[model samples]
Target: MKKVHLGLDVGGTASRWVACDPDGQVVARGSVDGATAHVFNPAERQRLGTALAQMAAALVAEDLVAVGMVGGLTGFGSAAAAEIAALAKEALGLAPAQLLLTDDIVLAFAAQFQPGEGHLISAGTGSIGVHVAADGKMTRVGGRGILIDDAGSGSWIALRALDAIYRVLDRTGSLAEVQRLAGALFALVGGSEWHHVRQYVYGGDRGRIGALAVGVAQAAEAGDATALQILAEAGAELARLAQALQTRAGDRPIALIGGVLNLHGSIGTEIQNRLPGTPISQPNSDTALAAARLQASGEEHAWRAILASMLTPPVPSLGSSVSAAAP
Candidate 1:
């Protein structure tokens, strides 16, 4: 009987799982809504937890003997890892040693590079940088939760855009550029009224709010100075993250991952220029694929070699467009 291993990437926007045999052959794959232990809304947190538990329960095979599972989950920290581990074991009937939970950034980093040295700057609803040393010790930067930190993240860009919109509404800024960008932002948010924007801002979850950055990116493409500044600043902040990691983890190829970078626009180019290397590019695989590779090998150094066989070769390095609506 072939041994089965499970890999999971649980994120704020979506979650993915893969079950594979020892040869790294995927036997089953599934996905569901995102899961997060860290969220402003408790109900949202519970919903995430339920989604994770249900996904795990549905994927686990009862007949498998002592299955191994590696989960790279967003918003999962030391405090919550044990609980999440417990939930997985309870739902899947696995033992303690069989389940391992780690920061999703680590999985991303592992996926992007081989056993050697490298850094990762990932932005989604939030942002973080992880540096894996040649010796495999990991150093983390700027995953301090969304409220205070997460500079250069999607939420950060969206918040800045919203601030500009409010400043325009209040006539707080005299610059015509600011006003023009603010109007664009207002229309981007919904365009009904200030009250509507306010409601959307306050009531929306982090993922929803972060998504607004896409509009900001679009506005920048269309020659909006404010939006350009925001993307430039975001790129700079992400560069700072890479620099900080480099200071400790040594200079290495830095992989940029996130929707912002995926847009492959000024923001992405800015990140590549900000970093201290050649050929700045996206990660070879997403978090879920990384998680699957990790579970299949259980070797910290096997990510690149294992995944190379499974994933398609990354697209040749290339470059976003300007649009009223964000894609």
Candidate 2:
């Protein structure tokens, strides 16, 4: 039996595992809830560890090669990816085996164009644009969520939707579409009044806004003007992030990932037009593999040197136009 490689992707709501054979073909897989959370107490950690261990055990074989993580940043902060990578290795009981892991965003980037030219704008519940130069040097250009600076993101859009409702309540105007989604969100969280939201406003519960984002998008898809506008603005901000990167990085290939940017018609199209460039496609392998390759390269000692190498050969290119894999 040959050892396989495992790739774990922890999104805001779920964690998934992708097992790969020696030839890099994805074979077995597993996932579970409780993978997405902003802050975790001991209970959360235990749940997470159990989920990971169970997934690994279920998918592992004598042929399994290594295990890597693409998400699960948690409270790790700036070193989120690296921290989660190591933590996942230990949690999976694969510490001594070869493990390749990194952030979900990195995986998204690589999924498009590894070591390729251009900027990538990812807008799901969160938003960020990353630029990996032909020179292997990866620079984070955007990705400050709403708390700090996410101008266009699911959170921003959801808040806007809520604001639209507030405006309607004030008799300012009617955001007809928001009525449904906002009500749905409040209902899900057991809050039926504005006071409930007000009391929890600054308490750091991200589930409400994060989850409401999907509803907003749904309304927009169903032809809600306010929802469309919100997404349009979000798309614009996402575009700006790409523009900023392109302006700074000499016109690299720009790849769009995340559900927000991929929204149909007006929003996504508008974004592409605003940020002019030939769109580079997504690749077959996940971007985590790209980041894993980077990690395997041991570029931590000299990131600049590693980036310079990317410039020399193996340019990034995507073979596909679009993919539905959510970030």
lDDT of each model, Cα atoms only? 0.69, 0.57
Clashing pairs in 1: none
lDDT of 2 by residue, 43-91 (tens): 6566566666776567554345454333323222332334344556765
Off by over 4 Å in 1: 1-3, 38-45, 57-66, 172-180, 276-279, 300-327
Position 320, candidate 2: lDDT: 40
Positional deviation of residue 37's Cα in model 1 after best superposition, in angstroms: 3.5
In model 2, the worst 10-residue window by lDDT is 72-81
